[model samples]
Target: MSRVKTAGALNKYLHLPLVLTAVFILINAGVYLLNTRAGILVSGGLVIYIILILVIYGRQRENMLNDLVTFATQYGQVQRKLMMDLALPYAITDDRGKLLWFNDAFAELTGKDRKSFRKSIASIFNGMSPDKFPARDQEIEYETVYNRRDYRIQIKSVVLDDLIDNSQILERDDQEESSMLYAFLLFDETELNNYIQKYEDETMVCGMIYMDNYDEAMESVDEVRRSLLTALVDRKINKYFQDLDGIVKKFDKDKYLIAMRTRTLNELKGLRFNILDDVKTVNIGNDMAVTLSIGIGANNGSYNRNFECARMAIDLALGRGGDQVVLRDGDSITYFGGKSQAVEKSTRVKARVKAHALQEFIEASEKVVIMGHKMMDIDAFGSAIGIYRASRTLNKRAYIVVDSPTITTKPFIDEFENNPDYDSKMLLDVHEAKEMVDDKTLLVVVDTNKPDYTECEELLHRTGTIVVLDHHRQGNNYIRNAVLSYIEPYASSACEMVAEILQYFAEGVKLKSIEADALYAGIMIDTDNFMSKTGVRTFEACAYLRRGGADVTRVRKMFRENVDDYRAKGETLSNAEMYRDHFIISVCPSGNLESPTIVGSQAANQLLNIKGVKASFVLTEYKNVIYISARAIDEVNVQIIMERMGGGGHLNMAGAQLPKVSVEEAVRRLKRVLDATIEGGDLE
Candidate 1:
């Protein structure tokens, strides 16, 4: 091979010299035709000239090759020297992620001295592997945090032929084989991130603070000392925000507008917004303590949008019965300090006004379609039935949207089935209801304000006239186009809210015995037989139902479960497991059970009776969805817990539905949520 390489190297240099020698030889041959001795001498001279030229050209080729090889070696060394001293963190790794070479900046970033260590780059940076990189164009870029510093990593791939073609470290024989290597450049971004965070912290945030129950609280005190109480409460509020570097302007006697930096908002969240309780501590011989509803908005991308979000958040906070803070950050809405029970209002003015609005909507609409939640429970169906009766009385064609109700609601449905007093097709399926809806149709959503939880979400979009009446605390997903939304989180049951609305719906509105039983059963079941959340208005609503001929004994008989359901409830209690030393977790038997969720709720209530138990959860696996029923006496706010799990309800009574999970997996998820809640200091 050496001999062949030498010959090949000398071949180009010899070509021109040999051609000139060949011409001299040809001239000698032509002269030989004239004189033999002269031609012979010329031929000899030509041969000598050819030998001299080949020898000289071969030596010249060797010298030139030596110079070229030396230059290539020096060039490779210079390139490597430049990379080694570069300020930017640079590294070269093989396809297997083994570091071949690295610059000084890379050594500094990795906190390692220059050495011959061929360690895997994975040890320095986690989740980085050549196998995970994109194949096309052989380039990748991403951001990562290392050693408490942010870095933007960029890596480019190169073949051995291009990257180290003239490298002196490898021989020409070794370069015949092809290999791949990665060049990485890391940019430190810690200071950039800090500056960005500072900019974000300085962004303006706005809020609305309203004195909840201001008139009611003022009336409870004497007219003489009311001014003092108001002043003290105002001072408490103003001082609370002023200490946090915030601006407060009292726009009304009971309302204030606030603006502050986002950093202050974060500090407020960390403190859990104690202002809700601070305002209540201002006691100067007043019979009632004042409560406040604070709503703050941030990250809406515009100042005006932040104010709009503040308005929306304040409305949501008030709708959840006040005494809370709702933070609307972009699309996320967070609740803080809602652990207190909602204060019940003694006056029914809002209910009367809402009833008049409902009367107007129903009377003017061409058709009315009442929608309850899917898998309707007693509260949902009863509230829906109440609205149906109201629509019927208004002389409009009304239909109740009922799709696959639970077994608990089957009894009421059977009563109205094929009856002469009701329309044959009064109860509509989801498909049938969608076809009946139009722009002029009135869509009244009862029991649930969440659009996804409604009987038919498509119907809500099909009609422009939509009214929402729910007793559940509003969560992330709700009807956005509600013409008139009447939500009272303090109410024991949605049926109770509807029952109150029905009284003021018309001059003389009456109910049939069955209808009254349905509504009464709803209140009975939701309030755990008037033993859980019953108040003055709760009992008054029941008394009103009694005056409407609702028989308690008959309603109790209607709620009777089958033998299988009775056994399932017993099984749920038997399988109950204690968690975190206070919460009880149980699973209701869902095998061949139609009303598993109702039985689960009943079982949850039953578990709460255990001594030292703060709350109870019953999970039932039905049709590939885990239905979780949570119940609390007062210590635990299950509404917030359930809401964090993508569900919402009253503080004491909340439920959630998780699809495509096993009963055991559902329990594990519940445990994870409980663990996170405890870590977040939201629970005991």
Candidate 2:
């Protein structure tokens, strides 16, 4: 095999030499065939042929050398262009790891001159050795500082081939020759790192404490004591924020704004932000405990929105009688720490002042008209009669708006029918009331404040001047057009309030026996024979009625029901079901001589017979309207439960009017409210 290969190589080289010799012989032989002149020409031609051959060989060698140089230059230019166009820093190194070449971007990234960069890439990389770097085609990212600025750098290496013919030229083979080790590329992501840091810092959240009863606390304190207490509060607030890198700005005398980065919201779970327990110990005077209400707004979208929510929650906490914390998140509200009872306020001065104001309003109007709830009860009729007498003092035309068929006051109905002066037109319907109503007409609503419950809702709308006298607790649905609203929830009945108002205007007035009897009956029925729900004002109003010739025996007779009605009440109580800790519910079938309200109340009273029962509710159907009557024993808030069904009253006694719903459906809704209350969920 070696011999055959050697012969083939010799033949290929010998052919080139033989072809050159043949071309030289042909040129000399052609010159010899010419004459002496031809022989001289032939000799010159022979010399020229030899010279041309030498010139051709020299030109071929020069062209080969030029081509090699051109190829080397083009290769170098292509490599340089590739490095410049790349987005990352790159470098080329020899077998010994000495930097041979690097891009301009690399010099900028490392903050070093090209000469120093060639000596050491490790100086800019915090002394990281390339020799210690792992095998080629691998990449790593790390953080380092260049020119005192933080940076993130990525380094990569790849193997390059260095060969002459078929043999590798390593530095060990020839001291001056070295093999190419690797080509490295780097990426600078410092701007990306800065963006991530900014995002993390911005995501950190911040949260407030307000003094709710500031005015009530400082009302009786001396100036020196007040100043000291204020300073103490400020110091405590500052101390709480000191370790958190926060600030407490005093925006008002009673309010302070706290600002803190809430990178630790999870750690604050169940921790009291208001700190009212500590503040309450700081006494002002008169044994008045210093109380405060706090508002916390969390997970709010913006700083302005959070501040507004906190402010609103604080106001609600204060309005609900202080000593509480209210939390508001968007539309949701939560409460904590309002276990204390509201302080009883003195209303005698307010009542007296309101009496004078009402007198002026009554005197200025063209006429005085009184009305009450659609189904007029004893309280409603009695309060209207009491207002009628007050109108006589101003010599104004007095009218009572009512539906005669719906009147629950049987005796009063009989009395009006028997009287010669009593006219049927005097008991005006809502339409008739509207015709007589005007801006000058004064409307006095009694027994109830809710507009939908009023007998003459349109009369209120027709007349600009209005007044409301009610004993029930205030609800969201109230008579907004009224000029005078004498709503005293503490008062036993509306009759009591009207009776007191009548006395204020009763200096030189003549007493009417029928009107006096009506008012006395109203006070009796609401107070349950002066045994329950009676206050100091209740008996005082009853005493005024006795002075006006109101007979107690006749008042009792007005409440008399037939034997069958009494039996129905007993039947309702027999079917009651007790649930949860305090609630007792019962359903009574529709047919009965007694009204649903009376049956429901009797059923509620019977459920109270249970040992642990705190509240009782009776749901019964009558004339397509589901009547829900609720009663409680001080501890249970029945009004809140009833309000969820779109009705409201006092804390212990309440009723709701549901439209055309069945007893089963109503009971299901009632159970839902009870479950939510038991589970400590929001009422609405």
Candidate 2 ranges beyond 4 A from true positions: 1-347, 404-408, 421-424, 506-510, 681-684
The lDDT of model 2 is: 0.70
Best by TM-score: 1
| TM-score for predicted model 2 compared with the true structure | 0.56
The residue-by-residue lDDT of candidate 2 on 1-684, one tens digit each, is 112222365456635844876776776677667655776776676678668767776576556556656887999999778877666777766544567777778777666576665665565466557665546557666676666556565555553433443455533445543333655566555677778766544443333566654655565577668887777777776776665566678878877776655443333334544355667766646256666667666557787787787876665555444566676655666555553433333346656766777888889998988889977888898888888878876788888887743324866867876788655555677778888888888899999989999986778788889998887865546787778877766677788878877776635344588888999888887766676567667788888888998988877777777676677777787888878766788876557554656656666776777888888898878778888988766677676788778897766678998997888899999999889875763221
Residues 536-626, candidate 1: write the lDDT tens digits. 9999998888999899998888888899999999999998999989999999988888878888999999999999999999998888999
- For each candidate, what is the lDDT? 0.88, 0.70
Give the lowest summed-lDDT range of ten residues in model 1.
1-10
Best by lDDT, which number? 1
